[model samples]
Target: MARQDTIDVRELSVHYHGHLALKNINFSVDKGQLIGVIGPNGAGKSTLIKAILGLERSKGEVSLFGSSVKAFRKQISYVPQRNMIDWDFPVRVKDAVLMGRYAHIPWYRLRSSKKDRRKAEEALDKVGMIEFADRQIGELSGGQQQRVFIARALAQDADVFFLDEPFVGIDIKSEEIIVRLLHQLRDSGKTIFVVHHDLSKVEKYFDHLILLNQELIGAGAVKEIYTPEFLKKAYQGSAAVLDDKDGMVVVSQ
Candidate 1:
């Protein structure tokens, strides 16, 4: 059987104070791929994610798993950038991870049951942060903190994931672990969308690519979308894609 589209967006547009932030963007994502949403600074990479998720005001149609976003929100998991979060929230690592289960809890309940705690611990283990479960989130390294966030997402057990710059300010080990877990999630049939900036690791991290610059430039396999022609269009002559032995790398002018 053919794979179904986990994310289907049509003519999605977002504007700010009469300024067009995104224009008639359209794309459909299949299940089980690590898709990189890439573009230059202020290219609306994060805006597109927010628009699709309905966090930002926009005009268009967005459906996840054949259902409207409102009906399927529980099936979606989002992890915003580290800078957007407060590290000094004074929350324990395990407690933070357990927050993912909040939606799963009954509306009448105020606290998590034993199963929720177990799932949270299991998620922490997956990110190799179980040992730091009792530690304050602010005390961990940048990478460790990022891992803890991913663990929280894992506990949600959602079919679709939106990660905004999870690799930023993270260490090599944390990136490696996160990427490995992402691949495993793909293997298990979950679609993951990551807003990434570094061009060097695009191919290494994501097989699928969505090149955006206030609009859709191209969306397809990395080999098809990650080229000089597309990069030029997306960056508007500000970035130069160079030939690298590993693949292609981008250098800003």
Candidate 2:
């Protein structure tokens, strides 16, 4: 039997002030796959994700789990870039994570239930941030903050996860933790999409890849998409491919 598509995007396009950011992009992700969205700077990687999430004005069709994006919005979790978040938000780590449960609870209910608090605590513990639950988000290091954000997303208990530059400015340990969690999530039959910049770790980190350059360059298994040709096309010849004993390493010039 064929695998079901967890995410489907067709003819996706995005424009900002008449400037084409993404054009007629198309891709589909199957269940239990970790997909890396890669491209050069300003190559529409973020735009594509935003369009698929319906967070930006775009022209295309985006479906999640065979349902329209709007209908399945709550089933998806997004972790934006760490730099995009205000460091001085004055929110505690647990409180920040508890925000994820707002969708499941009605606004008329003033307080979260015991189940919600347990879920938030579990998420924090999974990310090794339980001890810092009461700490102010602004007081944490960049890597710690990133982990908290990821915990928040995990607390949502969404089937689909989208992360943008999650490893940026993060410590090696944090990156390792996040990658391990991603693999664990994938093993549990969840679909994960990460907007990543480091080309060197793409092969080791992701099973699938979506190459973008204001359009769809390629989308498939890592072995097929992480080739010299696709790298050159996406990075405009600024990428140099080196073959190693394990696989390939792409270094940007």
Q: Can you give the TM-score per candidate against the true fold?
A: 0.95, 0.95
Best by lDDT: 1
Candidate 2 at residue 227, lDDT?
Answer: 90
* Clash-forming residue pairs, model 2: none
Model 1 whole-model lDDT (C-alpha atoms): 0.91
Question: How many clashes does each candidate structure show, in the order listed?
Answer: 0, 0
Clashes of 1: 0
lDDT of each: 0.91, 0.89
Tens-digit lDDT track of model 2 for 107-128:
7999999999999999999999
> How many Å off is the CA of 169 in candidate 1?
1.0
Query: Candidate 2: what lDDT?
Result: 0.89
Model 1 steric clash pairs: none
